[model samples]
Target: MKKEQQEKSFTMSGEKRSKVYEEEAAYLRNRRSVAGTHTTDRSGIAFSGGGIRSACFSLGILNWLERSGMWKEFDYVSSVSGGGYAVASVLEREFDGEGSGKTRAEMVVDKLRHDDGYLRSKSATLFLLVISASISGLLTFSPIMLLCGQSASLMINIYPRTVDNWASGIFCAASAVISLSTWRMPGMVGKLTLFIAVFFGSIQVAWVTGYLPPNLRVGMGILLILSWLIVLGLLGLGLSHPLIKRIQRASFLGLMANIVLTFAIVLHLVIDGTGKTHTNDVLACLYIVSLGLIFLALLASPNRLNPFLVTYYKSLQTAFGNGRDDAIWRNRAQQGDPIHLINCFVQSPRTREEPVRSRGGENFCISRFFCGSQSLDYFRTATWSSGREKKPVWRHQTIWRLITTSGAAVDVHPTRQSPIVNGLPTMFNIGLCSWVINPSFKRKHRKGGPVFVLNFAAAVGGNSIKQKWIRLSDGGHFENLGLYELVARQCMDIIVVDAGCDPEYRFSDLALAMEKCRDDFGAEIDIPGLFPQRSPGRCHQSKFEGYIRYRGVDKPAKLTYLKLVVTEHHSMRMRLQSSIDPKFPHEPTRNQFSTKAFVDAYYQLGCETAALAFPVTGTVKRAA
Candidate 1:
């Protein structure tokens, strides 16, 4: 029955997929005609991801393109990460048609210049996130810790305690250690250790409760054994069967039931208060502290809050004056602007059928009309925020949220199945920067309730994909260039703005994009001038022209690549190098609080680089 339901949900016919593609193509064509930019071939511009550095630099490129009347020629604009920041600003202005007689780029620069202390604002937001998580954990765990500690003290001081009871206690602790230590081991060893642990733990529970009244002792012991058996059975099914991963949640539910039962025992003992002593008090205090530490460790999962306080929302407020009030989606749908594709990655559990090009996840695209990926197929953007039950909820499917989700650049981790590298940041609550969203079709209820305790449990509790929630972070995690989607769309011409940090000019991001496009879409991208000799003393030429050939297309597409580098000498660049850090263009992306001069320097450098590459007369044909 369960398999049938899943099959029904994912029954995407080949005709349906083709229709989706055709519908999107027709929409793009209509949009181009409406904007008076229709051509025989489609064109797109891609902005690479690199936090604020990419945003400010892309703004400069847009300024020049708009001034030269070249921006309106494109049919699509694909942006990822920080590039989305600049694109969002442009869309905001275009939608509202209210820039106070200033160009969109100029207005954005002015707002950024006024609020130049970005670092301070970012730090305050991070501090607030940390403090709130800390307080929440303390308040949620204190009572449970006290109850468990008191119950343990009572069990230890039970009247007429025998050697068998003490032995059971020691054996239980030893088994628990062995169970936890060997949980990750493969083959029969892990299963055997777990079985031993559960067996001994159940016996210990029965033995420790022997001091209770005869009827109550028997009933509690029987209940504990049954709960353990049920949990163990569910675990066995989840591991042995491939189609019933959802049963994993049932196992957790069984474990939770056992916890509740244990809590009941603790509450009863604390109320009885027959084993009160100074030593017991000290032991309870120590247990509470230990539990507090555990809760703090679990607070690392930041699903409760969004971390775009300064980077995204503040930028929106600066650009539009009112961040959340603007109807970005509605405006774009009704206007003739290019189709905006905010590229993001959905972190999903890896399956054997998944293509190697997916890395560990799938490419999730958020556009004005549709939202989803190849794996999930497409869904209407208007109805996406409607909960799984199709009920209206607080809509999170907004353009600004999607843009921020695309630019979620910090605290990223691999999927749950992969071994976590550099997990310390996640443990320290730094992973809060990643955004969690509802899946397109399989959206589940927000796990847990309003209570912080239950919410914390849900956040850190299970690592099952059956939960049906989507984890989205920086597009850079999968592909930074934002070129994959354009290739997927099979655009005839593309201009890639490479603002990503590449001081060494290795072009790793570009290489990754090219490789994925070739492997996934059978699209070959070749740029002869992409590789140049590295020289520390001189600036490398930053513009290159290339061509791409798709698998089934008869005509190859033209590719123009623009990188953010100091290709030509500028007065602002010289001033910045002399006064501020020498690595003006190649500064670390962490320098979010750069001064107005810093912004102007990058902006000017961008304009000058674009001009030198593509002059007014258009004489330059390739990289110099």
Candidate 2:
């Protein structure tokens, strides 16, 4: 018994041993990684915002996923606790030998001497990091989106655009160079320094020796990266580690190329002071600049680095089973369905320098895709108008409908009147519009073809300009033939396009229309509120004229409608622009269109003047 006990103790000690003592003197490898850099008090306020943002993002997404019924399969919430703890343990300063960073380093070292194996492993890790970053970036707007089945149109609409893709290429290239140069790779100091110096020094030498010029740097850089990629592939093949070999085969070179161009064009306008240039060029530059950085950041994230990206390369990874329907029937899943809506992504012709608008459209697109897709599965119904027609090219059946700004909901004219309308802008008085029809509702809602999903190309997020646009009503309604039977509508049969006075479509109007539609349509069950509530928390009221005054600072225009009326119970903060990024171009001066003050000038005067005749109810929640 004593001998056995000694043996067991020896084995246990071996199991617990990590490389903690190998090079404990080094601060980076010896100390710890900074993962939860936001939660610590030593962290900056910017970190605080990011931490709060991430938490809100996590909570919001999880809640939506559960509500959408996808939470059952994903198990993201429960798994998050374990995953978070594991990550914390590995990232903390005190944790010994469990870090993947260290393990990956050791693994690399094992094959370093074998050129072919080393090359392949390196390439594999790089490629994996690329895919992970792209996918992660894509998921930011649509976390619950499914990538396969009848709902693939959702993927199409959500995919990044040409310019954005180009930008990603630029961003990835820069990040790769930066990371490679700065990598605190686990190795002898002399060896590490030599590696970085050799690789980086080669580029510098190429430039100084006139082998590469500023104009041709991009081309030269590509060649440099390609050389690395080839070396990795050969190295990986020699080692026969399928994962690294897969990365070599997948080709990060091409993907990064696309992203690099995206970066060049996007940066042309952002920091180039080219807003006065052609719109196409300006737009192109803006996209590449923003998207490039984003992609680069993704490649740099450690969790996504090395050997994990082998998963997405399989285009045929049968994600979920489709019902026994023919391909023809299967593909037309999104046509004119209550749960499916066509969204557009607009961009100029490769180059432009223009002011980009991020707020209005992208918000509408994501909300519709995420919220609309979710409602169909748990709260609404989706029908394939194309399924009935039997063709991919016909009607509202396909997943993505690319309409232009001309298709924008605001232009359609209103033919009727709301008698109560007096001084209100004619835009809001309009009543019904198309796009709200529920044709599939009358028919037994057969489990709608695999959940039609929504995609938010980073374009649509609040970052800058959005190439992806999800069509929604602007100060209008689409109550056609009651909410039940969609009146046997045809794909292009013109669903009686009617408009009223409202020029802008706000949440307040949608909620009202939904409520009235309950009885007007005579449905068996009426959802109490598909829209959010309207109060200080849920609703915001602003006029175009009032907003114009918030922009100027010098002769800061006193907005006719923007004077605040603050009080005790309620403290309102209003500005021409969003309060989050309150500063405007003419902060100290006045552009007559720039923001000057951030005030609520109590609603007393505005409200008293306009009796609460058109009060809407709902909570105004910001998009996560």
Candidate 3:
């Protein structure tokens, strides 16, 4: 019995040992997951949006960091729009801490120098133009033709077979617009008032215009009345009490309206088609397809088709502008070229204070070479676009390369010897770089790499205050650029490179965006609350220097904002123009970047700047 007891004790002790080992292993696994591989040393680098110039500058900074043997310090890099291209370039090169024979900076520069033709290829431009034209045709120009035909059918009864189709199309569009516009109107009275007014107005107009047959007019009126009753009943229920609050909270009101409109239009078309000709059927089909395209164009993101024009016109009444063209007017009304904007600012030579005379009496200045720079005030109050001065609207920044001078471009400080119009850094394109980081926080639906293509315009919901779908423009639209992304990832250290267009080179954008991020995302980040604005004679030492300390509840990240402003002599534009068209004396030199020297210079500069930030390690070679 004593021998048996000894054997049993041994078995029990062995089992206990195994169990303890399993528990310890599980604990380590959980700890590993809770704190990522680099939890203690988590760091991120963000590049702000400044088109191609900012991108090139980011490459330069990356090169310098890599040379300093600190590239490995960064776990992830993020950027907005044009900055996205830079992040992509760096990721694609995948430069290990040590250069892979040729440094990524060198590769990037070399690629740009040799790949200029690809960017400016007729095929690429044609492709963009074709897409633009298709979008225009499907949404705008084509609809005009359809509307004209429908109008004629209503007034002159030319297409008797198609009268009902035209009337139904009109009703569908009107209903959708009304539903979307008034969906958020508080109180049942306001919503009901608008709905009744719109419904009655539409039916009366159709009757007066001969859009409805006299015999079916009564039936149509009764149908519309019943439809309105169902809608009103639903709205009443939605706003009544806590019981129906769940359904209201779901906010499927938009969907409900859409369903009702679709049903009503289809029913009318089907009933009217009982004795209609085949010609009518085809016309009806065409009308339906065209209407669908219109809705799709309006509702879809601008990435697929440039919808700036549509929104611009829609908001013209509220937009601030003189509604007049001027000499200093750049292509503010045209679509911005993200690539060219980047190239022009980073590479172009600074213009002299005196204007160069060009053909047709056009005074060529530096401001004429860039667009979308005038509207980049990080701290400026937001306002709708009205054709007037002092309004911070997106379209104002749309100015194309205007060669003429304007008050907007000039710094009116009395201390200046002359009004400095072109002195401002054009690449300081609002320091606007939108970033979507924190894979965990990304909308569950937006899986995959769609994160890269996301711009400021895509992330926001409809403006609840305006009761209009926010026409999301570029990442610059919101002004809350890249810094927030780093914070969201719980990065312990963040290095930011703001190569945007800033005349004073103040970190206003960085400060404002950070504060805004805190407000919007509950991000715990902090910057100088009373940071001084850019002023002359202040030594401006703060230009390339500033830091924002994270002051959140959780352990904060150390933030560093580096202003990477490239001078004219070192600019890629000047280098490109000198090599490509050095002989132009009588005309303004157009910007281009298709050479090796320019690439070498930019690459070297980037390396040098990064090296300055983190000097190379000699005794120990730290992995990036």
Candidate 2, residue 15: lDDT:
10
User: Which candidate ranks first by lDDT, i.e. highest?
Assistant: 1
Tens-place lDDT per residue, model 2, 323-384, is: 12122123322211111122222221111222112112211111121212111111111232
Off by over 4 Å in 3: 1-41, 94-100, 121-135, 140-474, 479-481, 521-556, 566-601, 617-624
Global Cα lDDT for candidate 2:
0.24
Every candidate's lDDT: 0.62, 0.24, 0.38
TM-score of each: 0.71, 0.18, 0.45
Candidate scoring better on TM-score of 2 and 3: 3
Candidate 1 residue lDDT tens string, 1-624: 977877666232222345555767787777777777758577899998887778888888877776666777787899998788887777676432653445567667777778762334557776776776565545445444544444453344444466756776787789889989997797558756775566556445534564578698668768778877876665444132334444653354455447645654654455356544454565666677757645553443344433433345445445424355433346454455678888887665434335622254667777766767776667666545433354544334566666666776664434332222222243333442333444444445433212233233333222212224455666777788899988988889899999887777778889989988987789999998567447753546678899999998989899999987764444455445635657767777656666777777776766677676666764422211
RMSD of each: 9.6, 30.3, 20.9
- The candidates, ranked best first by TM-score, are 1, 3, 2
Clashes of each: 0, 72, 36
Q: Residue 265 lDDT in model 1? A: 61
